[model samples]
Target: MASENVKLEPLGPNKTGPNRIQDDGIDDYDPHLHREVESPTTNAETLIHLLKGCLGTGILALPEAFKYSGMANGIVSTFLIGLLCTYCLHVLVRAQYVICKKLKVALLTYPESMKIACEIGPTCLRRFAPYAPAITNFFLIFYQLGICCVYIVFVGKNIKAVADEYTTNDISLTLYILMFFVPFVAIICIKNLKLLAPFSILANLITLVTFGVVGYYVCQNLPPFSSLPSFGTLFNYPLYFGTTLFSLQAVGVVIALENNMATPKQFRGAFGVLNIGMTLVTIIYVGMAMMGYWKYGDKIESSITLNFPPGDVLAKVIRIMYSIAIYISYGLQGYVPVQIIWSNYMAKSLDNSSRKSLYEYMLRIGCVVLTFLLAITVPLLGLFISLVGAFCLSALGIAFPAIIELCAYWPDRLGPGRWILWKDIGLIIVGIVGLCAGSYSCIYEIVRSLASGQT
Candidate 1:
């Protein structure tokens, strides 16, 4: 799939003619026809990319997530969350198409879509239109950076786990994280998305192999359904909510993937790329969470890979190989924040400078260093995942899209009796509640862990 480098065309006058009109009054402005992709991806390729986006280090955390929500509740809740996320994605994409027709533009990025939606929305929100992009970008940057931090901690912990088995010396997780600083900086500096494509392909292969091995281990000697609890406490559900949200929602990449597709309209229907990919993703997540939790019961680690027996060479290889996969993924995850920061904020200021390239490299290094510092500072993988999910994904995945939809279709045509309005309001409420409750739960746990002098 193409990267976010696809340029957004300026809004032109709305076209109106027999050619531009469909049977319905809606304009026949097909964004796909206008998209100038150098190498557009087929539906199958786009589906694969979508799967990769949703399945990441987050998948390894689902088993731990299930530990908090329990067996039956986790399974049901994960499916529901996945369904909600997929619906939100559909709405966001649909809203973009609507706004794109109104604006007569080929495509828009997430933040760009938000900005335009607000600009053309109701009068009450028109004043805030200028700030919409900034707000959306803020959440996107936070979520992307959080993923990078998770990657850092994930890679460090797995590497530390494997190394601990080999020698008597005890190396700190922080040291392992620090050791990757140079390598992380080196890889991230590559900049070009094409240059990183091979690494991404390799990582995906390794991840699939790792998952296969993990599935084999977890499936063998499985515990009965009665072995684990049917449900967990109220407070723990927020942890489950956050982790599942983190695991299932790939809001950041949804627009880019859709924009780069050869058949963009095929991305949201019943049998389309979005539905098919997310269905598979949800099933894989549920299977992993249920099986991993059942196998380990209450003693499951934050990542399933950590649950593998230490004495086993195959387990060691799994850890090392999965870590390598995640290590490569760090660059891919970090690419978003770098693109947003550079293209939107920094590039303009340095457009005339002789050393613009030098400054861009510095920005890339700075981003890697920031995530490294954060990973070592917290290092609590579970809590960090929950916090990022609750705080960022809550807004990016659910709330923002609903808000954009409301603005995009305001004052008319919100379905019969304005059901769309009510529905969006409910979604916004759910997003807000999840944001507050889940974030508070994760923060409280982090503080308690720190207060008790636990790393």
Candidate 2:
């Protein structure tokens, strides 16, 4: 007999063993036992990666997010969004585990999980299983490309800030973006993950130092709370929703991190890596938003780094360092979409071609150019962040997970009294509303900015 802890017991003999699943319908499969990761990541290592994933360009935009929602509202709403995002992440992972156990698979990517869940779900959804992976990949690819575009704008704007100090001539942000094109292409062309690992490490370290310096500046000369509004106008709340969602949700990498764990089971539960990491992330985000907003008040820039005094030598150094950090991250961020486009769609066609390597390099350069064009077209960082967050993450981070959970559990196993069903429904509704409202607000802002002759 299988252990009591096992959710499903296999029929006949050959039970109570790792990676053992009989021909019968029953399954005593434990995903953890079956995993064959050659170099599994420890819990602490996974936590660090989680932190690095969540703490990207989004963190720098939270204060501006606060600018949209007001300090008090921003604090409260950000925490709530963090909670929601965390819960959704838990939902997705739990569903993945359940589906993996049923399928007797050691691991499944986000799209794979969605596809398998839909295949085994309620009768109505089984037919849609074929399309799930493509849809999921669509969101994943779009979100990653959106991130690359943000990095482009972020690096360009920071470099522009530093150069504006040295020269009185007004250089277009487009020119600065163009200046870094070759370097961006050079870094993106490096296909070896091992080579890129060092750059990722350096970027994380630089980000930490940048945040520390930013904290120092924001902490000094704090403004009184009475000067700022407790709640912003309703018109701007969607922008806040989008930015906070963008900042708090790192759904793209959650499954990847969980799948690579040395002990995958330690990724969830009360004190699991997910909870602890997200708690610290939420706290950091809230602290940055509150402090940055309080310090700069209405004068806060899209990135808190920009709000730093330009004349200060330290501020210039910080800007340059952060620009370098984000520039490095562009390659890391761009890697995802490139892989999805090439391996999933293009590589099969060129399997026997001698110039396959040549095509891949061209694809990489093409992605850089695509993001460059997008960055130059809508150079506004805050609006672009909001749009991407609202449009892409809303679906990937929130709605799709809820839908996946619903399908994975199906007609039964939806918790006592079907509470999970209702809860998932609520999440799906929230995601949809956030997507629509946030996207609208961002587009409106972009159009208004254009009309006002602002970049």
Candidate 3:
């Protein structure tokens, strides 16, 4: 195993120790200071990865939900949700960079990244601030897998639709699965994020092409779009906001990028770039979804393929490209969370005397099995994702950051609230409100949908 692997050279970040990361936990919970191998990533590279990973694939299919929700409500929901997500992304970035800076200064391991920012406790969460990154990582892998499966379905559908003219059946479902297996397997073996940088750049270009095609088509048919639906269509906003939360979810990406930074010191830079890019992408995304909905009306499906009329060659080609690009995007974006969950799972193996490689395989298999269970049992993928993400990831990524930061920054405000320090208390209240409003709306819709048997 050692010889088959190229020795992991010090890319940039220092190693915490060569003691083979205590996966099975023979070591104490105390932070390890030996420098860890810096993952092959830069602030700039992380920015690109975040954009391609978060914005590229989901934006294509999300308009389907908007169409279901109706135009007026759809656009409104998109903006409001976008605003909430923007805030969540901002807080997660600020919290992570703040925590990382303290960890580096203390010469602590990344797992203990929160120790300097918060008081330690017996639980791994308090000791490690588990929910923030660790819990979010779990759901992120699930989100990646869900989006990947959606991509695969879209790829097969688009190809079959177009290719059917050329051959009786140019691509079969079996062939599609078999075809993706090689590339998917190839991606898994690529070592780390930096090696895949070129692919990330190409994927972003593909997204731009998708943007060009979708934007041009919608703008060209503006009159037709407005006439399709009007103000009475606003009722579907709740569910639309609920389901499409998938698009705004990037807190896990924030944490992973921070972790993988070659120089943790550069988190401020990476985060700055990440926020700027996301702002621009959000504007483009809302526009695309709105225009796509307005142009196609309620006839759209979750993958954008349905909106492209059967006879238009350009639309057909766009569908095919969008599907394939999303497939690659999901697979690539999925890898980080996969590594993250695996890392935490392996932190057990690395930290313990009983550490074995088999745990790695088990973790992967476990996730696949769980995804299958949820997908089969749950009627709506969007609702299922939002449920898990809101209760878990959103809490960890958004709420926890605000809580931890407030606690760390303003200790006096931690006392019994109403009578306590007003200034800091107000900030906490606003954070809680945003968290509750955003999370409540999502969770409420999921529950309501499930009750009505819609999800």
- Model 2 per-residue lDDT tens digits across residues 255-291: 8888778888899978999999999999999998899
| Candidate 3 runs further than 4 Å off | 1-47, 97-137, 163-186, 192-195, 222-236, 256-275, 347-393, 413-455
Better structure of 1 and 3 per lDDT? 1
Ranking of candidates on TM-score, top first: 1, 2, 3
lDDT of 2: 0.86
Clashes counted in candidate 2 amount to 0
RMSD for each of the candidates? 3.1, 5.0, 8.3
lDDT of each: 0.86, 0.86, 0.53
- Clashing residue pairs, backbone N/CA/C < 3 A, model 1: none
Colliding pairs, model 2:
none
Model 1 lDDT per residue over 221-324, tens place:
88787979999999989999999999999987788788888888899989999999999999999998899999999999999999899989999998988888
Question: Against the correct fold, how does model 2 do in TM-score?
Answer: 0.94
TM-score of every prediction relative to native:
0.95, 0.94, 0.67
* Model 1, runs deviating above 4 Å: 1-25
